[model samples]
Target: MPQRLFIDVHIVQTVPPANVNRDDQGNPKEAIYGGVRRSRVSSQAWKRATREHFDTTVPEHNRATRTRRLTSELAKRIVHDTKLEREKADRLAGALLTRLNLSQGKKASDTAYLLFYGNAQLDTVAALIAGQAHDLAALDDEKLAEAVKDLPVADAFSTGHPVGVALFGRMVADIPKLNVDASVQVAHALSTHETQLEFDYFTAVDDKTEKEETGAGMIGTIAFNSATLYRYATVGFAQLTDNLGGDTEAALDALDRFVDSFARSAPTGYQNAFAHRTRPSLIAVVVRDDQPVNLVTAFEEPVPSEAGIQATSVRRLAHEYAEASRAWGDSPLHAAATHTFTTDEPRSKETAEALTAAFGDRISFDELRSGLRERLSAVLEAQG
Candidate 1:
């Protein structure tokens, strides 16, 4: 059989009184599930939080920066590293980026779109201008433009990719060849139970105020909702490997960092007022050789409120998973691991370890990480 690779992650988390993701009107994002409203946190919000975790937790990992100030940033580097004056450096940097179709505005002071690039890529562009600054400066306007056109912009990314760029990928509007499709797909998190929106009327009193003042400083209403959220994301091992240029070790490392960060990170929205910094109550990691399966349909009817929502949701997940395996057979499932904090729910017949038992060896978080890598490496090698 051909080697197939994919990782599906499922998480059940509960957040207390907080607004993790808000919409345009300053209310928490929501969606209709099972004919009832449910609180929601956008995929972008959580992905950003996960990226921030990767930035702080992963050491020696080359990271990418997403910004609109590409020309300005490169100009500073040119001035600091080379003997060119600020004015000359700015012009040269703008010219090089303009040729690449990355700059806009009269002076090309900023990028037309947000550019996600690695430190190495930016450094290469700066070094190019520094090397030929004098020769390029002496040319007429037409000659300088023609000279830059001959530069090799495509070969700039010859070196290894930064971890962030490799994972999230990037798109160059005018240069489709430079576009990198994302290897990971994230689904917007939705609440398992029906939502009940609430508002908090807040006021801030000025520290230095007149003694006879009747009214306080600022007052406003903030919208929020609390519920158990079902979060899902999938990582394509084949695409990840290709993105890393077939480097197996780097792919494994990327997988490790991704899973860890996704499990621990939560968006920092309205955290100052409501510090809802909680971890997942239940987590399931599935490694499949076939296609990815999302058990979200189990909640399509929405779990009943009679039984505790979290406990009932946990039971429904296990029941649906068992049904899925029985219908599809174990050929698709390579391995599985699960972790749960809510163990003693009398309502739930399937505990974390019990649900994951038949799928694969029940193991700790660290063991699961290492074991998956080892198993995947063996599978990939045998296929070769």
Candidate 2:
């Protein structure tokens, strides 16, 4: 609540019979909440899917690369930008990375952990090396340490975290100071109804031997479940802007991309077999002048309906949200949208309309994202 601004995204998406997220035993993940087992998909899986979507769809400079080959990746950039030989570039990158204390050994490729770094960060390092490449290449251990003694190795290398890193975060155990605090918090999506795990016993048939062969090429049982899931995430507006080094445009772009990708992206687990690519039946966006309020408890009792689980879940979510808003006082701004629901679903329709009206807008996804960006931009301008 100390932070004066936050964005909360609440969703109701119903996936058909599919294994979007799986446990170690290959069953659909589940959690016991409100004293009943419910189908669950981890926040990690969904975040990864959304990040992957951004990497492909968003601009290259706006995304970060997560990899263990940090040295090699940097060395390639140095070689390309500074025109240094691969071996020299590799050595320079190694020396600079050693300043972070992340190397296991003297080998240029040795790194303590995978790095999630932005392209701009790599360019800064390359520029530094280019400026002092000759001197750094010639210096011995003692003199080399003295020559680069004043470099702001930690903070300097940490600027310009890509949109993904700025929103999600990066941590290096050996260099904790360089870690970027995550501005967004994602909750593990859980079903709004009781979940029962099911298995699909499938057999692969070889094309060469078809009709006459009674034997199967491969046979196995894959576990899965179907559920109407409730997904929630909260973004700290202040932290998000700060994380981008006060670049409001990039911050706004990140917010827009995050909402779009998070809404459309689904985990790829067993997708070839299940093909459960589903859009949310309902989405609620709330911008508050206080801390985030998650509505996962809306389904604490689990909704049952002979007609449709999504319909029941939608009604429950709207009612619970309305009650929560009333209890907590009016939110600064709110919006809701849906991809599916019919006129016949009276309770669902009424609840959705009431909730939308209470939220102050019933806009499409694009409009919702643009409005959020405009609001945040105005806030930034006002603060400035």
Candidate 3:
């Protein structure tokens, strides 16, 4: 059997008063953990943020699009590649999707649900349609379905998934064969201590109002909270490699991007109001050959804010990691950490030392990225 390898990432970040993720009532999301309510940010919010970050760093060819407008998107490509008009191209695209058992929404331009598809996959499908554009466009819906039933339209989506799709996976409820199992799992981020929501009540004045105007144009209240969060995510190297068709190089690239993206990405909810774009104070990466482990249990007792939560949280996490290592009986293949404290206090220094003692090395963010890539590449090559 191929060796099992997983990369676990843990983060300690502090955000100012901000509603980065909110519930239906427009309040900051929260969850009760360890007998206390902790501020929460859903995994879906973070995943969307991470995927958005990928657009800036990862190559366009390696990215995927998640949208319900798959038909309209595919139709545009068909029209561009063939002489068919936009209307005919749209009908052809819809027919192709219908043959694949992907139903259209109430609007013909939209799919039944959001479909995650690779850029190259859509291009390939468009190329295939362009080959027989006139013939396919001339047939009625029924005849078109019969003519393209076995032309391998669905195969394009079953393989060659872009990096985003491979990491996050795809679910085609209508067709299980098109599903891709995710290689990464992200836990919802939670504050390390108890939190209470706060509200910001303000008024927006109309810019064009006269100087004598006493009233404001709009008034509202926004609910938010500030917390030092403990975030965790893990990526299965073997699964990622398999997802990329056994291409270790591509898997390594994806891993590198994942680390950078997860560490930097922040959900944009109410960002303009709170400007909560703080980078993590601590980031620890562990490469394990056995199984992935999350060290969040460290904060079960809730770190107190009196001694500075960010520094205290870092120390707690390191101690928990050490305890887990001892209990597991087998050390991880590799471990490293990078931290940035806003102040050079004694607690900050102690936290840094603790991390070095537990993780075995303290490096810069750049070093962490390069080191992980090197370690993953060596393991994957050896397994091959």
Steric clashes per prediction: 0, 0, 0
Give every collision pair in model 3.
none
Tens-digit per-residue lDDT, 1-384, candidate 2: 124678889899989999988888889999999889999999999999988988888667556888878788878978887787888778777777667777573544856567888877877776776776766867776777776666665665578788888999888777788888898899999999888988999998887885767888999999988989999998887788788887778777888888888888899999999899988888778787767888888899987735578877777777787788788776565454644554457755665565565454456777778887787767767666
Clashes by residue pair, model 2: none
Q: Can you give the TM-score per candidate against the true fold?
A: 0.90, 0.89, 0.96
Return the top candidate by TM-score: 3
Q: For each candidate in the order shown, give its overall lDDT on alpha carbons.
A: 0.78, 0.80, 0.89
The sequence of per-residue lDDT tens digits that candidate 1 reaches over residues 1-384 is 225688888888888889989999989999998898999999999998998888886553267778888878788878877877888877777777777765474445876788877767777777776777877877777888888886765556534676777778888777876787787888999888888899999898999888998687999988988888889898888888777887878988998889889989999999998999998766677788777778788789876655478866765676777787888775654556655533365444355445655445456777767777787778877888
Give the better candidate number (1 or 3) by lDDT. Answer: 3
Report clash pairs, candidate 1: none
Please state the error at residue 200 of candidate 3 in Å: 0.2
Q: Give, for candidate 2, the lowest lDDT window spanning 10 residues.
A: 334-343
For residues 1-384, could you state the per-residue lDDT of candidate 3 as single tens digits? 237999999999999999999999999999999999999999999999999998787667667999999989889899889978999998988877776778678886788899998988998888877778998898988898888777788998888889998899999899999899899999999999999989999999898998888898999999999999999999998788888998888888898999999999999999999999999989999999988898889999998868588889988999999988888796888899888742366657787778878876678999999999888777766877
